[model samples]
Target: MAVVGLPPMGCLPIVITLNSPHGLKQRGCLDSYSSVARNYNKILQNELQFMHNSLAMFGARISYVDIYEPLMEMIQGPKKFGFDKIFNGCCGTGYLETSFLCNPLSYTCPDATKYMFWDSIHPTEKTYYYLFKNTLPILDFLLKD
Candidate 1:
């Protein structure tokens, strides 16, 4: 079994828009939120390690997939992975609109491959592909027994 860590929620367009300072137009990620996510990951990792050790007598192989770093890398350097828009989604204005707000009538970008997110809370297929590709090694190791 492999458990994946949380992505950088602070960097999500909706989160950034809602948390940014009143006068700041850049709308980048909130460091406080990022720190919370990091802390949660640490706790989860420690718990998983304890479980792995406890189940060692039963021949259990539990692995932890650190998705935070790679996802952050993609968010920080989207161009390196062929993504042009890391801060917004493909639907509508790509800011706070998502789900019902990003309806069938809403305008979607011509090319979703250029965007990292499909909506305010979800990632695009291209982003998922990158995440899946990065996790292949861990999956292989887990399956090797």
Candidate 2:
């Protein structure tokens, strides 16, 4: 048997970001829409919370960060943050997000600086920079001894 060394919690950054369009669309009310997606997200959240708790129980120090709530809040009240569009991604031009592939010939935003999404499933560098900037507080907490 071999023993593996685990990195110190303070030295590692653990990030969990949730992006569930179906889940957000089905927020609140039992029957708004997409019962399956809603149920899946609920189950997933519970499972993730359970995992976090269990890991902590085993003396594995960890930090739980929620990128979902903040992003959701921004989406719900975009005007408060100077963002006008939330639903439409800045890249791609197809019915099913099939056109947002990261290729040289793929259609992209004219100016990624002005948009939130760089592709169908991911944010632009500017968006990532914004996220990182806002994440300083969380990082500080995690880095603290």
Candidate 3:
């Protein structure tokens, strides 16, 4: 089994929208929220390591995949990932619209690949592709003996 860590919450469109007036004024993040994710990831990684060792006697394979740094890399370097919008979603205003709010009436961006997020809470397919790429090595290792 694979356990993935949390993404950078400070970069979430909804978080940014509610926390800042400028909203996407810069490709930056709130250290407070992001730090929480970091701390949580550290704890999760440690716990997973404990589980991995503890379960090894039973021949259980539990791996930890880190999406935090990879996502952060995408956020900090959007242009490198072919992403033009790092802080907003592809739907509606790209600020707060998510799930039910993103109805047919809410138009979507022409190119979702250009946006990191598809909605306020979910990442776009392109973002997932990059994240997958970043974690593939660990996944491959898990597949090995």
List runs of model 3 lying over 4 Å from the truth. Answer: 24-27
Lowest-sum lDDT 10-residue window in model 2: 8-17
Look at candidate 2 and give me any clashing residue pairs: none
Q: C-alpha displacement of 29 in model 1, angstroms?
A: 1.8
Name the lDDT of candidate 1: 0.85
Model 1 off-target regions past 4 Å? 22-24
Query: What is the TM-score of each predicted model, taking all chains together?
Result: 0.91, 0.53, 0.92
Number of clashing residue pairs in every model? 0, 0, 0
lDDT of 1 by residue, 67-129 (tens): 788879998888999999887789987888888998889999999999989987789999898
Q: Compose the digit string of candidate 3's lDDT tens values, residues 1-145.
A: 8999988888888888888657657545777888999999999999999999999999988888889899988888889999998888999988899999998888999999999999987999989998888888888888887
lDDT of 1 at 71: 79
- Show the lowest summed lDDT stretch of 10 residues, model 1: 21-30
lDDT of each: 0.85, 0.45, 0.88
Query: Positional deviation of 139 in candidate 3, in angstroms?
Result: 1.6
- lDDT for model 2 comes to 0.45
